[model samples]
Target: MLAEYRQFVLPRQRGLHAEIIIIPTGELKVNIKEKNNSLKAEFDELYFHSAGKETELVCRDQLGTESVRWHLHLANDDARELAMLIESAEEEFEALMRDL
Candidate 1:
């Protein structure tokens, strides 16, 4: 919606991450959770947006389709704030790791 990203990362598990490319031709979407806990090491899909907090995480349902859980909207300042906090926590985690 704002700009185009060449490559993006998606999650499959608690510590697993998958790299994906955002096709500029289609609508941007992301799948966070796997159905029935059938995930192996990555999420159901990947998304491309948000510098860090300006993003959304979608959880698809209905078994084999692209539904949404955190789809974007006309406004998402609160959501963005939450995401920013998560990112900040991760950064702090990395700092902790370095300290350890």
Candidate 2:
């Protein structure tokens, strides 16, 4: 366990929303929800690509069925926190890769 993040929700189309949770093991536990319906997805490896004021969480899940490219609209403070979390996740990922 290296780092963990608190839950954050971002709105999507048609009342859908994305709930993002960063685990200590560098895995993103995501829950896409709308009303009473929800779907969960996990990404063990994530790439946070930033451009201008937008940031994208890039990852592909198993079965070749789930593709994730979450566009995050974060406030200034939230963006800073997210950046720190991403750095921690990247460090943990690198350590795990080296161990393999």
Candidate 3:
């Protein structure tokens, strides 16, 4: 699979707690640590418009990787399904951002 959807709370570190929601892109590695009484997150993923435009989205063969990396190829109905996924994510994200 090209992507995996995962949501869970990160382990507590130092003095802070964190939560994470993984969005599809490739193999995501998230690390959370405490910093100044707050939470910090690190990952490999899609952020803003610059994401998903590089070799990160490429398949294992194309990337010459040891792991069997996956890639997505959407067409017609499949493309529509992707669109729906995005819309659904966006709707919830918008609600989340309302407090910002």
Candidate 4:
């Protein structure tokens, strides 16, 4: 999971990049934006769980205090497929940020 985080995403230039930490519970966090004088648009307390064939991504925001959840199911684990998934995710995230 840590390897995936490091390989798939780059450092956030304007906001904050996703970071993975190994503590009491493995977690992932990202600072997506800022508001006022406080850290805003940050996602934390992320918990990833895998079912039989799907993975779940759950996260909470620091400022809005909202929770977002998503899931991914992979049919095959191949380099090309993985690349496409990462690229698609990045494009989607970028579009979302632009909309905000």
Over the stretch 1-100, how does candidate 4's per-residue lDDT look in tens digits? 1123322221223343323222212233233223222111222444344554444444455455665543223222322334444445556666766788
lDDT top scorer? 2
Ranking by lDDT: 2, 1, 4, 3
What does candidate 1's lDDT look like per residue over 7-90, in tens digits? 223322343232222222323333233222222111334332544444454445536667644433211453454344444545
Question: Could you tell me which 10 consecutive residues in candidate 2 have the lowest summed lDDT?
Answer: 36-45
Model 3 Cα lDDT, one tens digit per residue, 1-100: 1233332222222333222233432223323334322222122222212133221222233333455333322223433443454445555556666766
Every candidate's CA RMSD? 14.9, 5.2, 14.2, 15.7
User: Which runs of model 1 end up more than 4 angstroms from their true locations?
Assistant: 1-56, 59-75
Per-residue error for 66 in candidate 2, Å, reads 14
Looking at candidate 3, the ten consecutive residues that score lowest on lDDT are 41-50
Q: Which stretches of candidate 2 lie over 4 Å from their true place?
A: 1-5, 9-15, 35-44, 60-79, 89-100
Predicted structure 2, TM vs. truth: 0.46
List TM-score per model, in order.
0.32, 0.46, 0.29, 0.25
Reference-based TM-score, model 1:
0.32
Lowest-sum lDDT 10-residue window in model 4: 34-43
Cα miss at 37, model 4 (Å)? 39
Residue 52's lDDT within candidate 1 is 43
